[model samples]
Target: MAFYTDTIDFTARPAFSNAIRGFFTRIIAAQNRSIDVERMQDLSDAELAQMGLTRDGIVRHVYRDIYYV
Candidate 1:
């Protein structure tokens, strides 16, 4: 008996998507700074957890729709 391994690789198909491009470039770069001052000003524990983020961790994991994405 012989055992074989299967490998899967993906090649990204280029698309003219502004959102996809901006998310990686603009959003990632912008997240290096403080989170929106007014947005997280008054957040509940549930809301923060739903977003998988804490007040302190917002700017760090600051990608919009990060959980879903």
Candidate 2:
């Protein structure tokens, strides 16, 4: 019996796929916060106060996504 397959995978990718995975990871991370950050930053002081969020809290808000799981 003689059989073969060509299933290129992460191991065969650039930087052995570490770079690719990392690039997508960063993109997802940015996506997770971009909307919230942009909307919050657009709000005035009173609006942010009503939301109980501050510019300083933006970092924590993003960090919550990374840590929650």
Candidate 3:
């Protein structure tokens, strides 16, 4: 399944808009973190070998997902 990482508010209320925006932001961040961790973990020994990645390399690559825009 696919999910949106953002929301829109047509209410034109500052507090309400801010709250909703913050909520979606947190959700997207969490989802992205989870995806990165899961993908890194799913790599097999041969796959990691092909990518020249060790356990530490996977951790480092996954951590870099936080900077994704």
Candidate 4:
């Protein structure tokens, strides 16, 4: 008679899942920023000034947290 046993490890699963989730989160954030930039561009200079933002600074403003520029 003989007995055999095996074990499977799933330690990597959570790390992989987190990576995928982070990737999609960033994608969605980027899309939302793009929409914000477009909407901001449609506003007149006076309207943008009221918001304390400039057309040239739109992308930088939207991505300020991610980019230093």
Name the top TM-score candidate.
Answer: 4
Q: How accurate is candidate 4 locally (lDDT)?
A: 0.92
Q: Write the per-residue lDDT of candidate 2 for residues 1-69, one digit (tens) a residue.
A: 998889756655667588889989999878968877777778898887787877778657656757652
lDDT of 3 at 31: 89
TM-score of 2: 0.48
Tens digits of per-residue lDDT, candidate 4, 1-69, equal: 998769878899999999999999999998999998999899999998998988898888888999997
* Global lDDT of model 3: 0.77
- Give the worst 10-residue stretch by lDDT in candidate 1: 7-16
- Candidate 2: Cα lDDT at 53: 74
TM-score of model 3 relative to the true fold? Answer: 0.46
Candidate 4 clash pair list: none
TM, every model: 0.33, 0.48, 0.46, 0.84
User: Per-residue lDDT of 1-69 in model 3, one digit per residue for the tens?
Assistant: 998867886677988889999999989987887787678778887888888877667766665645542
Arrange candidates by lDDT, highest first: which order? Answer: 4, 3, 2, 1
lDDT of 1 by residue, 1-69 (tens): 998779644434345465589678966666643356346646887898997877777645545544433
The alpha-carbon RMSD values of the candidates against the true structure, listed in the order shown, are 12.2, 5.9, 13.9, 3.0
List ranges where model 1 is wrong by over 4 Å. 1-35, 63-69
- Candidate 2: where is the Cα deviation over 4 Å? 1-22, 67-69
